[model samples]
Target: MANGIPLDGGRHAGTPTVGIVGLGLIGGSLARRLVARGIGVVAWNHRPHPYAEAERDGIRCAATLGELVDAGPDLIVLCNPLKAMPGVLVGLRPLLASRPRITLTDVGSVKGMVRQQVEAAGLGDRYVGAHPMAGNEHSGWQAADPALYDGALWALTVTPGTDYARFLAVARFVTEGVGNRIIALDDTTHDQAAALISHMPHVVATALVNTLVADPDRNIAAALAAGSWRDMTRVALTDPERTRAMVEEDSRNVAALLRAMAARLTGVADALDAYDDRALTAFFALGQPFREYKARERAAALAGAERQPEERTLAIPAEGWQETLLASARHGERLVCLAGDHTAVVTAAGMD
Candidate 1:
């Protein structure tokens, strides 16, 4: 039993039975992946079409929030819009009262406000906030893909009342089960990082599109648009309502980042106006090292993903060889010292 939760040994045992609260893109994609893995899914969607679609896809559709709770899910993932999540949480209280064992999580991008709402509703103990950095410009159930979460980074935020063991269970379910990398952080930290990485970039992309479309020379620019412009503005193709909700929900952090970006742009403009070659060169050169570092990080993560963990028992030469054996083990290895030998569990990718 994990934290008073029943540990029933069955086909569904050890694996979490998920009930998703929305059947939009993320929710639908998750349901598809989970169901494909033979995990039973009980999903709820306000829209009839998505519910029907989920049913067609072999997921059990819940008629109401109460019905979803009655389905007795080990975890409930709220995949509604950022603004709509608090109300969903409040509405689930009555149902949650009888089934306190149900763990709750969400896939909302901006976690600070959601964390506040979860705390205010007194569901923080059972709530483990999560944000999967995976999605496309498309929306709805039609865009759902089982591979949506593959190799993605899923951020989990823990509050003061959060159950660490429950959080770990959810994290493992997400990372190991769904093929994602789990990142643990506080809600505030998650929000700030998300703003800089996701929210601000989205705002900038939309603003760039807006600025260009308003210009008289936009037709000419569009005709000549190439890889650079297309790459930067690709996010502008996202669903407007979804983008608007994300920005408005995390407006403070997004605004702060926007202001910083504006300040930097102003610096670049000033250097250009003064024809300062050195300053212009310095400004353009600043991004090189950062981009290179990010590339290296991505390469490392991909390389690590190729490795698979294997348990191996090694006979050590001496009693005090624990440190040496562990030190000699390859990266991503877990070493344990046994009675007369050392057991090294290592992730072997291409190693002989």
Candidate 2:
């Protein structure tokens, strides 16, 4: 399809029947959102606990992985927890082998580890990695909402061996299927950025709350907590077990990031203790670029509907499309959608 330049702008064969392999918060929300958009979704969960509610939400509940595979989905999204990915992949291996037309993807927070697991399962060629920048502290089917994906940005990872047709399928699935934007990247880049922005910050949030809880004046602190405290510690309120699993999956990157964060924090503490003017000045100004970036974002959001983020088209080479997209993403351009099999429309609205 990449070479063929299909006139339909690289859309999947038909309105795809998406197979979802989990019924938890992210999975449930995706299934609900797809169903709401009039796309058929067949879903299977490790337990049938959410089947009834999912069915009412118009998601077809499958009793087994084989049943889900039999639905003839264009792609199967493995939304299961990282801990359960191996088992789920094992169950789908034989079924997917029979249905060679199917592509594979997952919504794991950490990309590098997931690729290893998928490759170990012998599904590497069929795989793509996806991580949605969408979630709140709460999780589970009970917290699932179709609106959770509102204006979400997704990171899609690829390798040299990734089939272009398969990649296009997943791209369309994100841009057109879910009405979201994507940034193409490789596993290492995705993992490192994720650690810096999300994984390390989560640990920092946990430590902030833990420090408060261990304080002698904990009750006073709780009573005095307001917007700043709430914002700082909000993510720590997530299920501890869930946060632990996510951090452990990307332990290497998270640990490295934690060390770097600790160094920065210790520098600030030293500056504060000694009241070193130079050090304190540098410390306070460390985040100026980020603050300016946020200011620009807020100004853009408040700007009139007449204006929008800058947009442009990219010519994707048939031979090295992956490299092209990766470079564009690294420079902070986001793929809005594919204009054709070899051309992509990207926006300049992104963090440097």
Best by TM-score: 2
lDDT of 1 at 109: 93
What's the CA error at residue 170 for candidate 1, in Å? Answer: 1.4
lDDT of 1 by residue, 221-273 (tens): 89899999999999998887888889888999999999999999999999999
Backbone clash total for model 2 is 0
Q: Which is the leading candidate under lDDT?
A: 2
Candidate 1 regions off by >4 Å? Answer: 1-16, 297-352
For model 2, how does the per-residue alpha-carbon lDDT over 1-352 read when each residue is reduced to its tens digit? 4322122444443333789999888999999998887777889999999999998888889999998998777779999989999898888888888777788999999999999999999999889899999999888899999899999999999988888888888998898878899998999999999988898889899999999999999999999999999999999999989888988988999999999889988998998899889999998898898898898888988995766889999998878888999999878799998888778899997567
In model 1, which range of ten residues has the least summed lDDT? 335-344
Cα error, residue 59 of model 1, in Å, equals 0.8
